[model samples]
Target: MVGAGALIGLAVEFHALGWSSIPGNSCGGRYRPCPEGTTPTLILAFVFTFAGFTGLTVALAAFRRIRPGKALPGALAAAGVLIALWPGWQAHLWLRGPVLDPAWQASPDRPASVRGVGVWALGDGAGTVVRARTDALIAYDSATGDRGWVLRAPARESVCAMSERPVDGIGLVAFARDEEPCDTVWGVEVSSGRTVWERDFAGRTLLYGGGGVLSADGGVAVALGERSVHGYGLTDGAVRWTAKPTAARAEGGDDAECEPVTASSAGGTTRVVVTCGRYTDFHSAWLLTLDDATGKEPSRRELPVESWVNAAAVLSAEPFTLLVQEKDERGLAAVLAYAEPDDPERRPVTIPLTADEEDLALTGLHPVFTARPVFRAQVADGNLIVAAARPGSDDAERVAAYSLDDGRRRWHADLGTPVVALAPAGPGRVAVLGESQRLWTLTTGEGTRVGEEDGTTVRDIAFKIDDGPQLVRAGDGWVIVNADGDTYAPALAVRP
Candidate 1:
């Protein structure tokens, strides 16, 4: 049964990715055979067929083994017939087609659009928001469901990543390379959808940390790679400075393949932090920080635990940065708070996490569970907000705020379903999206459901404009793309 199920699973994946091609010249080449691409209907049909056949085969085999009589043979034959007819039933539903009502239009004040995954929108009032799609930068009007303006590149160049930065009264849309050996950058105006300036870099695959295209201080735009760091002028995309570390300096005695995890900028300079093993074994972890402006020799410090640091985030406005450390065999997890660069020698505040009955007993008071948690944590308003779900419970999700001053649970919100995205909207407020695809506004003490709509999956990271969260909806919903290159959503405003 396991083997049959595995085969069926592979078939479903192949069909969804559209790996199966049709045979030549059949039914005017219009009716393609086999998997039929990534359309949801075709994928659903294939999954149902596979599941039905697997169950039928298992049932028939089980009956034959148990009885081995004339009735057993007849039962197996009947099962085969039923399995064969299952696809026809599915086809009937498919051919009957989707029931779309023209009367189902979005409210005149709340229009929506379907942007790709991870697209971020910065709100500008009057239903207008600056949004980043997979290949273009667009201005979306949520009220009328219209795209006010769009800036798209030619076919030769692909947009790797985009960041919307508002400087003065103008919105700066920055476009960078999507692939390696990349060197082009373009900035467009949000109001008129016209190109402001374009610059070409001499490097490849520029990494944008923290503050979109410009640094937090608006002095330099920095990009980091495996072995080099480049800083461009924020006003114009001209090269301000470039730093290429030596192979030994970049690797720090560990394997040369391990790249540094870049840190977000603070004050006026951006920092790149790399962890390396002390010896060849990759056991000891060392933290190295480099300045974005000069990229000179880094200040290195050794951590206490000899384990890999999987993820780290910089906590702004606070005196220290929070680091998530995962250690082996010891079965331990630690959150280390390190002081700022000026006081590098100060000992970090280490909060050790362990798995024990006593530890679980400490629940809302002390740290519990040593296993590396799969949730994301950030500091909002002077409080540490962690979004985690209860173990082994699919529907149990909680967002807890821990006071930085005393390490106590200040407030906790039970989000009901699994939280898919969490972003800091402002001080004391967070924008959350659940697995149900519903949007919620969560604060320290309360969570309010803002809206729920079908056919929309929340992006992994959501952006907050002045008004609310910006979302993209597709699949089984109304998609309106006009000749002016506008995609509008009339279905989002529909109440259940």
Candidate 2:
């Protein structure tokens, strides 16, 4: 019985520590591990104590029967005590925090949040980039902090919006005159800062707009206007096409009342969501598909809009996911993931985001579905990849990926501190940057730890970002960007 209890305790402890013959076979239930929580500690302590007492009682019973003594039981108890007091991991470098001064730092008032709007980091290649109102676009050498190039906004006009990602090294930036709409757009070569093409249109967006303003790939650069979808040449900024979206099934007066809210483009596949209703009131929403290169509309599906849904935003385009929001609040209602391009026979999978405050919430970069493109979460390996963390803090506990089709979690790895930024490393791998300034890489296929570089930069440099942050790897060094904050201590730091 004593041995049996000990074996049971061992089994539970091993399982909790992620022991499994298979990668994810009934181990780590729910993937929410409170490694230092009091509950698990208390349970193991009680089991060991009970098992020790049972062994002592057996020894006494044997003593009265024959010749058994307390030697064996006493040695066992002392051994257990020693094991309980032992500290697990040694802290060598963490005890003395290492700090490295930045090679160059941006000013306190570099590109900042304007009129309560969010700031975004773009141009993910071998350079560091930031866009401000006056400095329409700026690129810096990652190691030297030298200004590579800057495109100033036109007089009396501010740079309003930019592309979510650069297409073949070209990025689009829009300028608005005074308080007028961001009508005039320009496609520029990001590396050289040369204007490739310029055009103007009736550029308007949702009333409550946010980041993820534009997305481009292949020959198409998509921008959602007030009621229409506009597609342009990604490299030349030439007008491709413009068309109004028709609902797959009309639920209101007609499709004319509908407004194109969110648009996402990846690998020649583009997705657009349109919401039809009166001012600020919900009626219905439509999920429309288009060829990213040609802007030809193929299929449109009317989403199963519930009363609790305030709006819908596409989290990823490759696998096609719609993030349903709680009505007039910051909570999430459900996540609807559509079928992949290759596998169209699979049914759409709908899963609800956790209402439980104790669990990690799926964090989106921006809440609104306007010209602004969402950059926080992405799709990889038929799953949506994003940072998930418990509420009430800026820190994220893990980076998790869930299958958009079946709603099954593919894998998750513990992020010891808040994840400030992350980007694709190479094929099948992602690089994650934590608030502690640590940088590491993990396999997107299995979520395995590929390698890690214990960061020497100070942890305080990271931001408690409400908006998204970004990590840019340039040459052999890295640039950590905290565009979410306005303060100047460590807004943008380059480490070589």
Candidate 3:
């Protein structure tokens, strides 16, 4: 029986460690069933725990058959061993130590006169690039903190918004100016500090309103006054096409009151989704899809109007366009998947927060979304991971994972900080940046403290550079962008 219990314990440990097998299982019975790859691990854990319990029963039966004096000592010893091993089993299944290498030193000569808004680790994670808001546009080397090149804007209007991503072997920098009648479009080469092309639209008002710069397949799109949306060629910034609004404006209504909320490009097309309202409180929203090649309006769909429509990340290409909208109530987030025009299917999922949860904000850089209380919640891999600090306490934060499909709580762990940033690293792992300047690499079921560095206060952090939770990578290390325009990359204690 003792041997059987030991074997069961070993099996449970293996399964819990992601080694054993189960079948078509959904975690905690939320969402859909688990993927086929997860079945083996689940079965192994169940069998091992059941076997251990059976062995305990058999050992108790043997104790009953023995004399009272001998039976008492034997039972006590078995119970003591079991008690000691149980917590150890849990510890082995969860806790991992901080991992770090001390040989690496911080890089010098970080970019000056800049504030990092976004960080991108490009090409095999060897080259780390950061987009900072300076008097000009600059890309800094993540490893050595060397400034690569700086491209100055045509006119000295503050960079109201900027988006940076690698496109066609060059870092594309898109900026919009709050000032009018000037060139708002600029592209800079990261390898060589040169402006490849610049275009000025005299009458076009590039909305500084929130949303992505509509660019894809080497092209850029911008909404002019309420009447038209224009697409430009990437090579020389030539106008490709201009799309007009589908609905005519009502007379006597103020035209300037209407504005676009978000614009996105995908599948060789650029789309402008706008929310407009009058001062009297009547509001309407529309989704307008434009062809990048011709700049013609292909389809337009009117959507239900909310007080505000927060743009979530783009999901998949087929079936529908998935977006999350936060309602006015605290702690409520809605996921809406809309089919293209002429398709009849719509999937809307409303995810409610825990009763005690509050102050949730989604990270802009990473694919995952986060909500904060004293405890925080992250959405990834079709699951929600919630981390909550204990009541009236601030030392350690406890985390719980739930399957997004079925809303089942999977597992929980304690992380040692108040999380300020939560970004997705890979499938089930998350890179958590804390207000304490500590970085923790965490998975749905596991976590470890990886490294720490001094960080500026929350108020000093700038959101203009797109360098928040979405940009940092836990597998490589925590990249710090200081207030003085210096970007620092420190090696994380945990490896990929």
Candidate 4:
């Protein structure tokens, strides 16, 4: 009975993981072909796993060929070991990392004038691919090339920027009114294209871009106004908390000079970065962390240098890091890391993103001017992983990892070709797609190849693949989204 239950559980797990070697499997009610597998090896593994522990033990005990106590102990140990190691074996031997042959392709269905700036795959099941254009946000079914929904900007208005990511299935967006930069915020549901709520900040306060949110729990929609930070309800857009710098200023310099520029949030804390100095050229900045529920300031830290020519951006809020820019809009200057979050005593360590070696210019970051904070580099595996380009070029040709503790270059892998984008994959690993239509995975710490031997390359595609694409794991496969301001490239492609 124990052996049978274990076998049944293993089968269920394999089915749940989409490892079943069936061609016409019901893949989200769409015609996605089941992934190719090692059928012969799978059969051998199954037979050995079952008979080695269960069948052999039964035969040995029933025929009195061996003692029941010894046979039973050996059988249980073998079964436990096999069950524990099963998942890893399947991940390595059966799945064999990512395959580039897409089950379906979604090309750019817009006019020649329309250009895509970003693409995101939201949700886990079945999944939907969202393409962000200057005009509207379009959702497409990943399994089939059908339109899920369209959330267009108001008449005479256009989409200016979007939130860093969708939170609790709601993606916050910013739109410009006529000639304005970004004056309104809208929360749109990811699965359904319903606008849950909208807030227009025109006459009341100044607006820059999208809402900064921590999580979905008792959610708060936080935004950085001209000089203050406002937290609204995530679902209803109701004002929950608001913190003005003058009222909550620390025992430091003048609070009048501090102007909120950009903000990001993670783990129930919203961090707002404000530049403080004269109007012409700011000298310093302050990073204030506010609780999501109450607008209470928990931790406040001072940044050394910030000016009109040199600016700072909140890169990742979870780990709490900042990117200082050389030019106002473009060029890498340095990266600052907060060793701890919400710890008042913690000081930031400044790390340079661009090295003098000319081999590590970051190409994965959004220009420093956008209202939306969409930083492509990620903090994973105890290091900051960033896509790099050679000096004097903008294409990402290498990936490098720097130590988060002391800001030292640990390792860098020369991809030989430009990379598409970086996406968080399994633990300690980030998925990388080559501009040549191939996919691979690398360990963020050691920068070792954990994917295929030579990586999986997708062939026979009829669309233009750009250098900046997001690699997303949607449902049973992967989705390659092209949003790098390419006017001619396909919006996205789905891997089976």
Top-TM-score structure, candidate number: 4
Report how far off residue 89 is in candidate 3 (Å). 28
Any runs in candidate 3 off by more than 4 Å, and if so which? Answer: 1-97, 101-114, 170-183, 202-211, 218-227, 246-258, 277-281, 297-300, 308-344, 352-359, 363-380, 383-416, 436-438, 444-471, 482-496
Specify the poorest-scoring 10-residue window by lDDT in model 4: 26-35
Per-prediction tally of clashes: 5, 7, 24, 0
Select the stronger candidate by TM-score from 1 and 4: 4
Question: Which regions of candidate 2 fall more than 4 Å away from where they truly are?
Answer: 1-101, 110-125, 128-135, 177-180, 208-212, 248-255, 292-294, 307-313, 326-332, 341-346, 355-376, 391-395, 452-467, 484-486, 489-496
Error of 1 at 476 (Å): 27
Quote the lDDT for 240 in model 3.
Answer: 75
What TM-score would each prediction reach against the true structure? 0.52, 0.67, 0.57, 0.71
Please write out the lDDT profile of model 1 over residues 72-174, one tens digit for every residue. 5554455545454455445533432322222132332211332321233334322344444435555655444455776675454544434323443233333
| Predicted candidate 4 versus true structure: per-residue lDDT over 419-481, tens digit per residue | 656778777878776655556688888989984655664533323555445566776567665
- Per-candidate RMSD, Å: 18.0, 13.7, 14.7, 12.5
Tens digits of per-residue lDDT, candidate 3, 1-496, equal: 4555564555556565543222222231212222222455455557767876787677667766774455564556455546545654554433322322221223332344433333344555535454445345555555555566666654545443333344554444444444443235555555665667665543334322222443445455343433445566665567776655544447855553444444556667665666566444546566667676887776766655455444443333232333445334452253334434423243233333332432223332222111100113456655565544554554324555545454445555554545555656666676665543334557655443333222211211222112233334423554443322344332111222
Alpha carbon RMSD to native, model 2: 13.7
Higher-lDDT candidate among 2 and 4?
Answer: 4
Instruction: Give lDDT for model 2.
Output: 0.58
Error of 3 at 389 (Å): 7.9
